[model samples]
Target: MIQRAETEHSKELGCAKHLLLAIGSANVIGVSLPASLSSHAGPGAGQGRSVFFSDGVSRIRLTLDENSPVLIENSGETAVLTFDGPGGLISVEGFVEKTGCHCPKQAYITINEGCIFSCRYCNVPNLDKHIKTPDEIASLISDAVRRENVECISLTSGVVGTMQEEDERLFAILERVRPFGLPIGVSVYPTPGLSQRLFELGVSEVKFNLETATGKLFAEMCPSLDRDVLCNALKEAVGIFGKNRVYTNIILGLGESKAEMKQCITHCLENGVIPIIRPLTPSAQLSHFSRPLAEDILSISEFLQSELLRFGLDPSASKTMCAKCMGCDLTPMTDLHLGEVTP
Candidate 1:
């Protein structure tokens, strides 16, 4: 019985590896596909090529011709799959076909000083530079949404001030941008009060990145912040915003076991949160640290998708919520939920 159990476990692991390879290779191939080909492909086809696969529990169909585009629609209209490339996977429920919202161009605004947490894998510099005023930040966002074709904007800042102060600044930023009616996503330290503030600001989603799976490694990476605090924050966010609106970022290449990653994802789902899994993109300063193989990312994505099904989550059900505004089209050609906004 012991030998049989070991064999079953080994098979499962091997299957996970293959799925990761498929996901990674799809990413590479997707990036290489020509713009013309991508433009011509239909909703279900990626660069005119569609890859389909089923692993008994789940059926995943994706287009791999550009930037590893994937469309995971299960049971007609259950859940929708979104990938962060460097984070993990996000399975959104109640998939609507809302038009994509325009966002500002990517710009780093100096919000505060260095991060209090010393994450071992992070390469972000701790610069003591001037911070951009709310007006300056608002102007950039307006341009991105109005001129540049941006659909969704993600705002992140280095940890600044005490937990209380950080929460204040985050709320201030969200309040400043709420007038635009854009779907904004913010990443912040896990603080329950702050999470509530974000939801109150009409923010569409919140991300509390659990960079690694293991508690021991998490402690080693972010020695300053308390892990329990992070967990509580995630729970609070989920409780406030439905699970579909709460996301947790997971970095895969930081020396964590598959089982550990699964366990972390399970916890997130149990608390009504989505795991946004992505591969490790080490900065040039930390190029010495090897990234997790592409296979590893695919494996994790498959695991999350399968687990989501078990929890009665459907990606197709959570389609884009803003489909009428066509100011900027950000939906991929392969996205079945392509709203009236054309990309």
Candidate 2:
């Protein structure tokens, strides 16, 4: 009976893995929440109000759309997700998770909602702009710590002024929250001395998003940003932050080829930086792009996991940010759960 239960658990996890990718690879899903249910928008722009759904094994952050073919209905302790299948409707059972901050057990805060640069795919600049003061940020973190299951504190921001100015603002906010003594992770545009400064601030980890896979695509997409600066920060971040502590976000379905994805993943692994495989969310500004298929997401995730293992970096070791959250992207060692890692 124990052997049979273990086999059933394995099969359940396999199903959950596929379902998570399926839900994440899509731009929207069908879910109806009671009007009384609280709504929370992610820190970034262009993101719709989303909810975290977790099965017993894995979790996914899904953007709700009433018209989507994939529908989720709340059922007492869990929820039932029904989607159109090749044969008919298929349903999976899970529960909609409640989060204290942007995600569960972590207060993911955004210092500023405005950006000066125009990254074609991002919708932050187009959204209404707001910069939270250090006191306000501290209050938010303090309240989450006092009232919720807050474990880590994370901060990301749009470049409202200059990168230096943003860094200064981030430092001010960091000073306010340092009293809480929680592991803090930050994601921002890399500026000179940013990595070393953040390390000295007692930050546990840091993320510098690459966004795209290659220089050519990066040049075309993020023309205002310097690829070299970002790369240099990533390298320095790995060295200062140590292995499994530095990360980068590489969004799929931005017209990047599989080869490009593999090459970028290899580059990050070579540098001891873990790459986050995020699916592109199609927006009005980026409607030309398509969301990657579930299979494509899985393929890249497998490749990333193999490379991370090869480089002696482990995503499961990450303490803060997306790697620890495992909400938005298919994290390598954490999500795939392929085999045991050698410490």
lDDT of each: 0.50, 0.74
Model 2: runs farther than 4 Å from truth? 1-44, 85-90
In Å, residue 234's CA in model 1 sits off its true spot by 0.8
Summarize candidate 2's per-residue lDDT along 82-164 as a digit string, tens digits.
55443344555777766656777888887887678888887777767889999999888887788777989999888888767
Model 1: lDDT to the true structure? 0.50
Most accurate candidate by lDDT: 2
User: What TM-score quantifies how close candidate 1 is to the native fold?
Assistant: 0.61
